[model samples]
Target: MAEKIDRQEVQHVANLAKLSFDDQALSKITPQLEEIIGLFTDLQKVDTDGVEPMYSPTTEVNVMREDKGIRSNQREALLKNAPDTQDGLIKVPAIIDESEDGDK
Candidate 1:
């Protein structure tokens, strides 16, 4: 068996992920993480000699819509509902800086 997860290991992982936690939060989180690791350790001991692995718990399938070509005069009506529009398209907030050269 692998070595158990300790408080220092958790703190190291938190530091690597750029997470800052005070002592009280770290104390609370350490045990919860330890319990999770314990659960996984228990799971590793379960017998599965003849069992088929279950990939998904539910039998539900995606109900995909049919891809169809549409011809419409609804462009004007649709743009009416938008909070902002530009060049006949809905204008959403940009996630990145746009260049003056219009390279975006």
Candidate 2:
């Protein structure tokens, strides 16, 4: 026999999850949710015994190759793509005001 869960319990869970339902919607869904939970409770009765836990069913290994640094010797080619460059570095707009110009 499966353990029975209350309809109100489902509503309480929904409330905790910040979900709102009309009285009609609640009435229709509560029994269905209870039935699903009841099915899960029924499944819990089945014994696994010596079943091994699997990360995935497939025995496939990672086909992707390791990251090989194949960087180009073309520094000028890379810097040419930048919108703004200063002192051989990519220049970006200030995220925060550290100090006003001529204040320091």
Best by lDDT: 1
What is the Cα-based lDDT of residue 91 in candidate 1? 95
Kindly list the per-residue Cα lDDT of model 1 for residues 22-99, writing each as its tens digit: 899998998898888787787667788999999999999989888998899899999999999999999998767666
State the C-alpha lDDT per candidate.
Answer: 0.85, 0.81
Deviation of model 1 at 91, angstroms: 13
- The TM-score obtained by model 2 is 0.42
Model 2: per-residue lDDT, tens digit, 14-61? 889999777898888878887887778876777988988777988888
The per-prediction tally of clashing pairs is 0, 0
> Which RMSD values do the candidates have, in order?
7.9, 11.8
Error of 1 at 70 (Å): 11
lDDT of 2 at 16: 100
